[model samples]
Target: MPGFVGAVQIMNIGSSGVFHIGDVFQLTPISTAKTFAGAGSFNTGETLTIRNHQSATNTFDNDGIDQGNNFNL
Candidate 1:
């Protein structure tokens, strides 16, 4: 799911379930979570990504962003 930076934005998440980067943001399994601080369970091998707007270039920084790997479940 190749998406342009800053081109996409999350409007909302439904009540059926919570949203995740890979689930709602249309990101790949390896992508890291860029926003939304929370403690939620995820499956193993699952990954997520988020944008880091605080950077100078406003680009997606792999180090600045948060990542979830090696899930407990």
Candidate 2:
């Protein structure tokens, strides 16, 4: 079976996000990060694939890093 979309409306697609209309084989969203005052070495990484798994099979879940102010400045 198939479907149709008459109209699509999107207000805001914030940083490191995705917006889709119809069907898609694969999607890779952008990544973003924020740092406090005088904080350095802010970085982020992502992959839509790994091993024999399909790209769509790799979702963005349980992906993050530990942040703190205990670091020596």
Task: Give the per-residue lDDT of model 1 (tens digit) for 18-60.
Answer: 4454326344343334443323323246565544545343445
Could you give candidate 2's per-residue lDDT for residues 3-59 as a string of tens digits? 687977788887767787678867766454453432222334564332434333333
When superposed on Cα atoms, how far off is each prediction in RMSD?
18.6, 17.9
| Model 1 collision count | 6
Q: Estimate each model's TM-score.
A: 0.18, 0.37
In model 2, what is the error at residue 58, expressed in angstroms?
31
Quality of model 1 by C-alpha lDDT: 0.46
* lDDT of candidates 1 onward, in order: 0.46, 0.53
Q: Candidate 2: which stretches are off by over 4 Å?
A: 32-73
